[model samples]
Target: MTAPAKTYTLLDAAGRPYRSTTKGLWGGHRGSRIYGRLDCPTALLALARSTGYAHRRVFFTDEATAAAAGFRPCGACCKDRYRTWKTAQENGERWNP
Candidate 1:
């Protein structure tokens, strides 16, 4: 008998959750709309502090999906990307990545 496949919850470009066989490559926060690496210090700190961060936790397959979902790069983990995103936001330009 074959074992059942394990599925993961991932967010699409529309920020909707779906089941996938592949795990998400990035982590995000639903309320804050911020995405970052799985090892992001800020996110870890929030989680460690028991601040209910887990309830708002989200996952994305890639940066493009996160961006399309209206999420921004995290300043703490994705410094360079955040700088670019911040500049684009300040200039009233759409961030492509």
Candidate 2:
């Protein structure tokens, strides 16, 4: 049997609502990033680590908000979709593709 998901409620930039597992982390350091308090998931951070968009990838205080804002899952630690992303990158489907 699997455990129930934890409840995570928090506010994000633009005053949007969100939820997440463990808190996210910083992708980069910049003053313009109003949501610096926010955090990106480790999985998402991994993707950012292996790509050109490293600077853009980061933790958001509210994860659901990040996802809704167009942020995708991180590929590195996220084993499930890692391969999917690897294939995409190889085929040039999402490498700034």
Q: Cα deviation of 26 in candidate 2 (Å)?
A: 7.1
lDDT of each: 0.96, 0.44
Using lDDT as the measure, the top candidate is 1
**Candidate 2: tens digits of C-alpha lDDT, residues 6-96:** 7544435444446776554423222232222224355345456666555443455543454344443444333444465468658877521
lDDT of 1 by residue, 1-77 (tens): 99999999999999999999999999999999999999999999999997789999999999999999999999999
Error of 2 at 31 (Å): 16
> Which pairs in model 1 have colliding backbones?
none
Give the range where candidate 2 is weakest over 10 consecutive residues by summed lDDT. 28-37
Candidate 2 error regions (>4 Å):
1-57, 81-97
For candidate 1, give the lDDT.
Answer: 0.96
List, in order, the clash count of every candidate structure.
Answer: 0, 10
Question: Cα deviation of 51 in candidate 1 (Å)?
Answer: 5.3
